[model samples]
Target: MSMSYIDKNYIYAVSRIRYAELRLLDGSVFDRLIEAKDVAECITILAEKGFGGEYRDPEGMLGYEKSRLWELIAELVPDMSVFDVFRLQNDYSNLKAAIKESALDLDIPGIYSQEAVADPMLIKQAVRERRYKELPLEMADIAELCHELFLRTGDGQLCDIMIDRAAMEAILRAAEASKEPVLIEYSRLTVGASDIKIAVRAMLTGKDDEFLRRALAPCPLLDTELLIRAALSGMDELCAYLMNTDFKDAVTELRKSLAAFEKYCDDLIIERLGTQKWNSFGLGPIAAYILARETEIRSVRILLTAKQNGFSAESIRERMRRTYV
Candidate 1:
């Protein structure tokens, strides 16, 4: 096969990812996990599948699996910054955790996610010590602003909203700066879906238009102005507005339930990323592989939790996301 520069660059990485994809948990694996009599049985099945070796605790096993995913990706991609769009949310999440922990003087364990490019502990230290210069420029400013907002108003929700909006904007900026079509599309879909979710929640809670406007981030795929207005009007108006946009198909899922809508959004992204399997070039395949693995891990976690709780198989299946394999 004739290979272009992009193809040649990612040839080895894609080949390795092909092998990695084979081990991804599919629907059958989830079925078994769901049917497992107890958490121990579920852990055994996961161990047999090489998910998290010897970690009996479900949370421990899941955490191990997440860390392993990032470790593998780090080994494959030399310049990890290429995937910053995926990791930026974790950074913001850590910032949120740190800011709240500092304000409340609470040592909240397991609140920080390890799937970020920046060290979570460093971010926590920077926030705790008010050392803004120690963090990245964008993050430093956001941390300071969120800290001040939380301190002044004692409104955790407002602080969270500000951080979430900033995170989405950062993801959008990273996607645009990369100039990768797949990354840009992924970012747009993520941000647009997030905006929709925020609007829906705000509408349901009877939040004012000003709150919605502040919470929703700008995205190329959806008109933010129209979205805020629709949200202010009600669910019907919001659905009607969505029908006219690129997210027309999501209307059905939105009607079903919020969980259903979330699944639909994730499935849409997975379907788009699945196309990268046939392409032999660039960062798309790598990005797809990472996302697919993350999705599979999430599905496994859900099944494990449901099984541990003795939930019905049908109920677990309903919440299961689309498998990439």
Candidate 2:
């Protein structure tokens, strides 16, 4: 095997990330996070751990914490220019908040704060003013699309589906553009896994075909109709449907518990990305390293929450994703 395809920069980037991952595994950080009573205390503790960033508000610290964590990692890796991806994910989340506010017709400040964008007011103004391109990422464009869907159907569910669909489309596009096998594989795996989750949830919820179509995200790997049909049938049928796909290895674990299955899938994806021997110069290795860190942070949060909530380690393990460990 000629390692000619490997980029030297990616290798260096991964090396740096491996060091950062070690820092995240520190027990003291988790102890501090677990000791925090409220969101403010958590933020303060995290700030002490070098999590510096301007959060939106006290109540929304959960989202702010995740957003800021990603931002810090982005700052660490200038080669990874996917701040827009994180911003857009936040925007999608914020758009959900915005629509909820619009539905309640309530006065909600810090709407933009929910979004990771620097000037959410500007993004909101852009959408309110109908500048879809100015939104943020391809996902932001989906949020804009959701606004139109909201106006047309008056169904919040449809708007949510539209945004999800747009995201799937964007990820598929990104996967296509990714020069490395790791990102392309990760993106495809993400789309497929997401479709499985949607199918399983739909089957459990007893939603109708129309709702399923409107609710399910459209991705390149799985056909929407197949998901709807499997969902309408049963879990066995759904599992059988996915068994032939690349994710068949997950079906056995998922059959035990949906939460476990989800965790398993996440670990698989993270492991797949983290193990790839990409060189450090390009966006590929950095993106993988960043996502890996985010996974570890979320895992720690889950552990802390579980400990605080009195959930057993077994129960917590069901929902825990694989980390650098």
Candidate 3:
């Protein structure tokens, strides 16, 4: 929220981030995690490395790590609002959870995110009390609509897609408002990736145009109309259209599976943000650090879940994302 947000050189922040980058989970730590005999050993390894904060269980430990991440970022930055691109999704996610919770009148454990701009508990209250004004402006109307839609029709999928599309649009607005290259690129990539996933999924499932149009959020990088047509026409057409955009590479992964394509999308962002390590000024490095840490957390979650499910190391490795380090 400064007059010129990135005018001040973040020398100390960049240096500290560089130092912290060394501690990011790398291949070796991941190897130990993958090879761990059980979840207990994995927890012990993560705890020894300064994770699992105050609890040994995965959910509590991961929640602690997430809270600690935001706390650390708040201490390092002048205005945390510049990082709304990362936090806004949590708000939308909470909105989704709150809508469902209110409609069902049930409290689902571990359903909401921690440390979002809006309190998750407050969102639940607003929806339950029918006080839309209590929610953030971006979410107020959508919360009302989604809550009613779910209540009236009991169509969870429909409500979910509506909220998902809204969340992507919210991310785009926040990214542009920040006027940061890293945020903007991440936002566009998110929309582009998500829209393609919708189209590909729709195509395979033989979804109609109305459903596709409703599900696809607008993006400057991809033509929503053309993508919709391609998806409706056939998978071949969808793959051909994808080949022309920057997301052409994603087509190959889409052929392999949705999970593979998701990993590709993630690695693509990390590849771009990877260059930010050399940046010593402005918000890019700090933003990249946030992203790197989030990716680390996500990767850990994936690996540990796979281990608990008895997945082979090779299968887990294929799903693991590229680290920032």
Candidate 4:
């Protein structure tokens, strides 16, 4: 931790982010995106709003946007220490993408090929060369970890569970290491939401005990064994089990649709993160701000897709994540 926590550099960075956020429309942009009939029209509208990237090609736009934002974040926090919280997630995403390629018997490829890892051949060669040693410190064991996960989980829902569990564990551990109250709270809320989602899916599908166990993501708030047991028991049992948790409000809705429940959880996380960004100290505020921006971008994309697909306004609204700002 740097002793100069409230220096001019930090203040300047925060002010720039605040100004950038203010330039974004609250709900008006979302409304426009939801009404866009085609990709071109959506891109034109985005350009009009100062999101002037390569709109003729969506992939190029994604790359450009990701690069621009990441560059800004780097400039804001030159040491990259503040973004370490995301290292675990980046490692996990890279591994998952590799596993997906392996499962299909294709060469290891990056899912976000444009922004990072543009060449599939290069990724394959790196894995063949045991090049984990050449990667970032946090990513050193990621290749091996992904391989192990695939061997163990075999591309089933459990694969998702394993990766999410690892991510949650990392967040909790990092929170502990930093002794940041906001991080701890955020980790607990995220894990609790995840548990709720898992429980709902298990109860709805009548999955096996083994499956439930394999699908569970490890979190600080939930006793994994007890949660699996409750999920296997019944929906009523699962709901009862979550009596004291943060996601109790979601239980009733979860009974209807797991997808909806999951979306609700995501919106809640984004909202909470946005709120934290306003009051956070040290690097936490910057990290939270980045998450909020990423989340907003996702929301806009979702809206655009929905509109282009001809979904109704009510349907689009239903799918929109709650705005934290």
Report lDDT (CA) for all predictions: 0.88, 0.64, 0.88, 0.65
- Candidate 1 regions exceeding 4 Å error are 1-8
TM-score, per-candidate, Cα-based: 0.95, 0.75, 0.94, 0.80
Candidate with more favorable, higher TM-score: 1 or 2? 1
Q: What shift in Å separates residue 145 of candidate 2 from its native position after superposition? A: 4.8
Give the per-residue lDDT digits (tens) of candidate 3, residues 245-268.
989988989889989999999999
| Candidate 4: regions farther than 4 A off | 1-9, 52-54, 100-105, 108-126, 130-160, 276-281
How well does model 1 score by local distance difference test?
Answer: 0.88
Task: Kindly give the stretch of ten consecutive residues in candidate 4 with the minimal lDDT sum.
Answer: 112-121
Model 4 lDDT on a 0 to 1 scale: 0.65
**True-structure Cα RMSD, model 1:** 2.8
Worst ten in a row by lDDT for model 1: 1-10
lDDT of 3 at 134: 81
Worst ten in a row by lDDT for model 2: 79-88
Residue pairs clashing, model 3: none
Model 4 Cα lDDT, one tens digit per residue, 135-240: 5444446456666667666754556666666666666676667565556666677677776676667677787877766656677777778788888888788778
